[model samples]
Target: MSIKSTKIFNSKQGMLIEGNSLELLESDENLSDLKGKVNLIITSPPFPLNQKKKYGNEKGEEYKNWFTKLAPIFSELLADDGSLVIEIGNAWEPERPVQSLLHLECLLGMVKHPDANLRLIQEFICYNPSKLPSPAQWVTVNRLRTVDSYTHVWWIAKNDFPKADNSKVLRPYSKSMEQLLKRQSYNSGKRPSEHQISEGGFLKDNGGSIAHNFFEMEALDEKRDVRLPHSVLSFSNTNSNDYFLKTCREKGITPHPARMSGGLVNFFIQFLTDEGDLVLDPFSGSNTTGYCAEKLNRKWVSFEIKEDYIEQACIRFSDPILKSPLKKMKA
Candidate 1:
């Protein structure tokens, strides 16, 4: 199906769209129109989890064909130095077994200019208990079953490396009680050195310190009373859509199911693109990417086929917490 390009929507610190991305890119528009433009493309495409839903197909052949047709345009839209991060999970069925990552690997291989197409920089695992079903064979064999813990997040870069600096987004470190006890050993008469003072001042004063990447960060900010989460997201079926609902209730707004936590999106924005760079989420779902991009001071465009999701996305973006960062950027 061909898509027609629509005018870019303009609004004050909120979600905007210009129609389906597939049709927009496939038009007679010049490729140069987007050349050296987009900084990052981060999206969690609807997993072909064989769920008999309107979003994906159950047949592997049909699934592969869909990705085959869609992957190339993404390559073309990517900036020479930009990165593409796609989150995919395994496809499972009792009767037939197939790995979705392998299909994605093959699809990516088929993109035009595989050499220039981008290297797989990293694979982030999105561990979810909800994605796993009770094991039929394992429960019978060992009286135990293991649930699937991780989904693949392929980080692809058109150039040799990502254009953004990642150290800025480093996970906070934790101080154990054992280490905390050692602080008393320091000389009481001695004043901290200038470098040590700045680095450890908060530590010296505050009773607790930041934890390492091993432990997840607090997903929500209680003081700010916002729903923004941390990079290492904790997925819960109950909390999946509750955050949006709460935010809406507080601000007199609505919710979107495809809406993801801002923490995950913020991590990608901080790690993948510099401020003011453009970010695109082709299969926008709830438009979480656009909301995150706005929060991180980046320009964003998203494409969602469903009008309901589009409206929800718009409402979510218009929330004060999401728009506050954008205002700071403009100032």
Candidate 2:
């Protein structure tokens, strides 16, 4: 898990530096090199749950202390207008789960800079827990119960808002359906002739338009292998790792554990950032933020402590689908 031995290696699209982000950030050479250059900060730091998870095993006071020590450096590296999006969930204890939103709020408040403004944009929920255990209290008495589901995603910004392009992320309606609807127009006063209507088309001469916002995405088709996942994501635990397995089977791509869903990342990036912006992820667990940033044509820097995870990230970054366009763009 140590990153001391890591080094930056040139790749097809960009360079992948292998080192600790904090250590690198503290170095005069590194800070001088990247100061005032980053444009966005999208990361999911470890929840201070004090659980024996794969990532690390720091518990209670130790966990909070670690986070407090790490927050300032990330704040310093962020640009004046850059956005910092941090995703954290409630730390589940067998007895009680602790919500991290207040901790996150405090973190932001403490990290606020005089020159760079900061604000909480949204406290939206990421509803991923689909399966629920029967209600514990009800089951004990009446043999019936319900389990709660959902996580929180906090969007925080510094200085100005992140640049975003709405057009690129637009969802268009089906052309055929639009045509059919247009032909059956209900405008009696301005009704056009059948031939004129046919030629003019139903909705418009151009393709049908789509609604704005992220809630319009359709559900996944298990049979057809198509999933137009919504912004408020819901995934069954059974298929949680299905996409990664499918990619591995079809294209030899190994998925990262802390990888955030592409759909989720796309929504945030589209709403909070523009193309060619620099995104920063200080506690990059599996490089999901970096992956999405690259996909959206944004430059990124990630800090990961584990060497094995970094290697995995390097492999994922080398995937043809993700790497090819970046190569083309650079070329």
- Please state every model's RMSD to the true fold in angstroms: 8.2, 8.0
For model 2, which pairs clash? 135-145, 135-146, 163-273, 163-274, 182-202
Q: What is the C-alpha lDDT of each candidate?
A: 0.57, 0.53
lDDT of 2 at 218: 31
Candidate 2 weakest ten by summed lDDT? 225-234
TM-score of 1: 0.69
Candidate number achieving the greatest lDDT relative to the actual structure: 1
| Candidate 2 residue-wise lDDT, 271-304, digit = tens | 6667776777776655666766776677776667
Question: Which residue runs of candidate 1 sit more than 4 Å off their true CA positions?
Answer: 1-8, 13-15, 28-32, 56-58, 97-116, 130-145, 176-243, 247-259, 324-331
Quote the positional error of residue 246 for candidate 1 in Å: 3.1
State the local distance difference test value for candidate 1.
0.57
What's each prediction's TM-score? 0.69, 0.65
Candidate 2's TM-score: 0.65
